[model samples]
Target: MSDNEWPRQLPAPDHGEWHDPPQARGRVLLAAGLVITVLLVAGGVAWQLMSNGSSQPVTQPSAAPVASATQPSVTPCPDPELTVAVAPEMEPVISQAAATLKPAGQRCSAIQVRAEEPGVTVDAEDQPDVWVPSSSAWLRIAADRKHVYQTSGATLGWSPIVLASPAALTAQYAKDGKTAWAGLIQAVTEDRVPVITMPDPLITTTGLLSVHGVHAATALTTKDPGIAQLRALTLRSRLTEAAADPSALIAQMSRQTDAVTASFQVGVFPVVEQQVTIYQKGGYRIPLIASVPVDGQIEADYPFAVRKGVKAGLAEQLRDAISKSAVTAAGFRTQPTAGGARLPDSAAEMLAPVKQWAQFQSLAFQVLLLIDNSGSMNEKIGAGTATKASLLRESGASAAELFNEQTTIGMWYFGAGSVSDPAHTEVVSIGPIAADVGGKSRREALAEKIGAYGPQASAGTPLYQSVLDGIAVMRPKVQAGRPAVVVVLTDGTDGGTRFAMSHQDFLKRLGAAQDPARPVPVIAVGYGPDANMNALQDMAKATGGQAIAARNPADLASAMAKAFLAARSAT
Candidate 1:
């Protein structure tokens, strides 16, 4: 029944904390910090394969008989039939539990089950009195929904997210006896594997956790929360057969062949252990083995959310039965023991990475690389023989590779001899990388210019005017969806008799030109100790962008990642 159909006085279901029993609480705590060491039994033997690199396929465990259920004849029923919405994957488990809850006279049905994805039900207009979503992550994401429901402490089922691959690939990845999450991310980033299919995280739990892993690994390795690696991975993966959802990927895996495996065309997938269990039950032409990342494991802990006005005793009884059926009937774990890697415990923690993943996949970029070719750029970098000018070419080329054809790019350089009208000489006009320019692709033109960049010993920095000029060039051409950005790289402060745009006047004019409707952010990077970071930071603030001070020239590549990401939020 809808909220209005039920009486208002029914004690509002627990809308606050997820109340867990002692054992469940322990499992949650175990899940919080450590890797999953929980033993999952299949065919009467415990699958202690998480820690050890076991290539054995997971066998299907024996399950309780699921009774075929029919519509309840509510003619003589005294209490209203309860409606329970469950995740499509968990529908059978819930249906099995509901089958045994017939009225005493067998003349009425006590409950009805609706199979739906949690993502759909969270915002559905008509909510069932009870909800069993696949993961608590959904609950956290929709925390502000108008219909408040109390989450049960008792998780209906547990399934650790696993990296699924053909036996040969699994063996290769876990050659050292175990593979880590960081290692899996590295493999994806480095393209060690033939194909690693990832679903869109905004829709699939598997995709969400996979992104979490990717971001965690990126942060662990780089010590910065940057999507540079993610940008490259997505661009490369687009070349493969992209799966619309996890089911499509799983279906593709079932057709894998030994020859295909040997040829290395088979792709790897991130999936839940329960799926691995279910897939093994049907058997595949080429079997897939589960590799739980040694460093950590993130699982879908399906929680039962009881909406207010749900029949009091009825919800509890059904929860118990469903919890019991989760293990055997649905191929899920009833008990979670401590041992796998830890994951973000709250929704707030997961949103940052998830948001980054969304933006990387959805947004295209239009950026101008405004580089400084002043004399200071000719100085040696950190006592190294390589001058800053040479390093700029390397760093610029590296960062440019992260952008795809859809991204638009351009370049300009400013210095003393930059007597051009704008105090910066344009090498490439802003355009999509795929667009043709002077018989060569824009990408090719940008690369050729970026590589040939060098410092002019007589040149002095004309940074202030260049900032205004870059914005002027970009403002009128700002595309509807693509984020427009100005990336300023300078080794020295504004100097020399250039256009007389004072710092205060430049900020005021820049601020006035900013249309809330069309934002063009400036990501300003200052290199070396002599660079004027304070002025660059002020410019960034005025333009709704970010500023980075790179003490070492090598750090500019990392700064570029942060630059693109900061510009991603531009209006």
Candidate 2:
């Protein structure tokens, strides 16, 4: 909306007194000279803080333009006017500042901030003189979107990226007085789920940054970031709710545990300090868990970029004035603290892999986990004490429990010893809370069924034929919004079963039987070294799914994650 259309003044923003240093309490150091500066790196990653010291805050002059004592007193002309298309979340602060700004006897230009979504406004027909996105990450993205070779902007508000958790989980962080990014990742890996709310990164900068933030904090240099793979492995593991934007997600997921029922919602997400403060003042109960990583925090540096035809001087004045307002009135950090070093030029290169995470769907779907329980499946997996079937069961249980309840899931066990084998069964029917096994809900029942498979794993794997039948079970229930898929976990390729159809024949039938309108992806999980990764990949790819290989105990979790992640489009 335009400034002219907004209220002359917003009701003084009920915010209490702003803290000069904001809520400063933790530290996570960044490697190299990439000392976590407040800058937007390319590829849409919000590189918030630039500690390299190549320059000062965009609007902060060395000494606020000092006037000599002996200079003659002369009235200056009215300063130029500049329009700021401010991000929706920052509009109140910017507008409030505009109202309180003084003229000093000479109109030092009029500054106006109007709410705008950077993705939309940056390419609008009537462009604002200045663009203030919530994250600097959009500066380059906006420029590139416009097909323009270049666009320049400066950081106006520096709010560090922080991990905000519900108070219920705050105890985990209270001990060390620091946020543990690794701990969160490890918990997800172990199926100790952390409920987090996620926004679509394509639209929200925080959503985009959250994907990168979590991965960067958890990924080691020796390993792949696995951001997508992580999401795949732990589908809905960390998230309990999903929303259109970060704030809405937080507010939606933000709830105190029901003391009477002993039930609580799970969710924590990356939000700026300013947001946390605003929410608190607005009566949100969730508190900051730890605003840290240890090396450094990802600064949420709001950048003020000038579009074509905008006067540079006016843009500069606006950048300075808005930045100053963010600090003095809104509690944002606009400059580096004492002894802070500049971020290295190499930091941009490191941000390359983060782009993929932003495109993640994380949507819920209906799925059936088809486990191969042939006699060969009982073989040991690598040198590990557990057999392939045991590890599969563990991973399956973890994955099933971690998926959000919104997802409809079921399970099936298939063996190759002829189609009439007594062992083959539809353990969990395709439904929510599927026929409570042993008094446990579908999730629990499935877990128990998987965990109990020991000496019972006998007969040949009806891998191909079982999937063909499983698809029949899943296809009829497929709905428009809730995609369906069949995930086949096998330790070996299709063979040895008397009732098994030829691999080629199975593929043709699976292909021809598929209804494009009611797609059901058949994803494959090759559980052991004997499994055929090549054939599995092909079968999965045919149904718009993927085949993941668990070559050993170590790759089991990651492979499962990759397979689950591929399930999004499987149907």
Candidate 3:
């Protein structure tokens, strides 16, 4: 959706009666003032309404579920089937409710939902019959004379966006009780904090909402500094619009060595839940908490509007079913609650509270570091380590530490050779491993194995064949939903498979082998000058993973850590 496509409906201009603070003062003063105003407004409204003995009139249902005559007519039914497009974040709870509705013969299907930035036009022109936007602002933008339906409730609202940090890093702020939105902005703008956010405003509704929340808070406080600082930070943040799915965004955030910060709405529960599961398996501790701004809150309303000329009966029934189910089963409140409910089975449970960092040190991640020891790895580069073996030995050790495993580590190194020649190519399995500097544990163990090779480098890289063999070795140990990442450190291209299949062919087969419900993410680390960066990137991109480049020993550790992070963070 583009800004141009958005319907024009700007908020009324600010009146001079509102204060305008200098941009240098940041958000604190503004936020505090806004908080006071909100409290006053809320209290005054309650008192006035109670005394007047008159209540605010509830707005009539905006529009009825009537079909337009010009559009295709749907058959009228006592109960018409309805489809609701939902963002992936809301999939679990929404789907759960949908599943339960099956006994009623209500056709409830959860379509893949895309969240457009407020004021962006979604291509719902010919897609789902109903569009359930992730936020209230987006709903207002998406609706027109052509598409109008009743809003069930605000799905979730924005909390004061905070920089999610490790407990150690944020302990001071917690102690100072400075975890408010204003505090966060001050910390980030002053370079006192390290935070992360998605890069693109157009793609991530959460990011846009976060910005809007800050803007709204600033507007209430008459503070311009907070807005300016936020704008500056947005420019420097490593956010990118490249992530195509929640899984990709999760993967990218999980891999970061720095503190992770993101703008998330209520719909992100599924992905958050998955993160919690992984952290628990790995024995890492982190708390995920939602922070509400002291000032007026920013809420997201998920609207389900029937397209024009849809069956009125069906639309109405479907809307009723969705409204009833969402309120009862989904973690949504018809109106704001004093505090949000913690999902007992949510990924957010693994998250530490705002400005807190919990150590993720206990569990060890088991990684199968598959190095391409084929002949092409020996190609000389302009400068730097030319051999793939040297690169693997140098890089693999540091990569292992990023996951900080508790037990067994496995390793396999292979080159072009028939299975008959065990000496030429071999698969070596190391400890339920301990972390070592370079060649002791699984990562180092494999590095050592490659070091011992007598340089009988094969003619080609059996990349796909190696991965297949590695997967077989790894498949047994991987727990359901715990990530099983295969970091393929390779040079050149995949060749020398017993079967004449391309890398894509191998990937297709691998994908087929996994349960469609759960798929393993594969990360590719391309090393040395001749490494096929493009091919590796393509492989990683295809699997919703990352393709990183490690040109030298210095870059290898970070790259390896990043690769592991990307792979593990994937939902």
Best by TM-score: 2
Of candidates 3 and 1, the better by lDDT: 1
Candidate achieving higher TM-score, 2 or 3? 2
For residues 1-571, write the lDDT of model 3, one tens digit per residue. 1222111112222232434364522353334334433443342223223323635688887776777788885654343255556554444444444454455653443332333333333534534555555554444334432444455433432222233333333432233543444444433333333223332334444544444444444445433332232232222221212123444434333433322222111011112222233232332222233334454244444555555655656445444445444443333435544533222132132121100111111233455767665666655444765555554554443233333323355655556556444312444564554445354445445545655643345655667666666656655666754446567777667656453367568768766666444444568887665677877776666556688887653355456555654655543
lDDT of 1 by residue, 460-536 (tens): 77898888888888877676786688889898778774665577887788887887767788998888788888889
For candidate 3, the 10 contiguous residues with the lowest summed lDDT are 352-361
Q: What is the C-alpha lDDT of each candidate?
A: 0.66, 0.58, 0.44
TM-score per prediction, in order, is 0.62, 0.63, 0.35
lDDT of 2: 0.58
> Candidate 3, which segments miss by more than 4 Å at Cα?
1-81, 100-121, 144-163, 172-178, 219-284, 323-330, 337-571
Clashing pairs in 1: 14-150, 34-340, 35-339, 35-340, 35-341, 36-339, 36-340, 296-341, 297-341, 416-460
Which candidate has the top score in lDDT?
Answer: 1
Model 2, C-alpha of 423: deviation from truth (Å): 8.2
Q: For candidate 1, which ten residues in a row score worst on lDDT?
A: 36-45
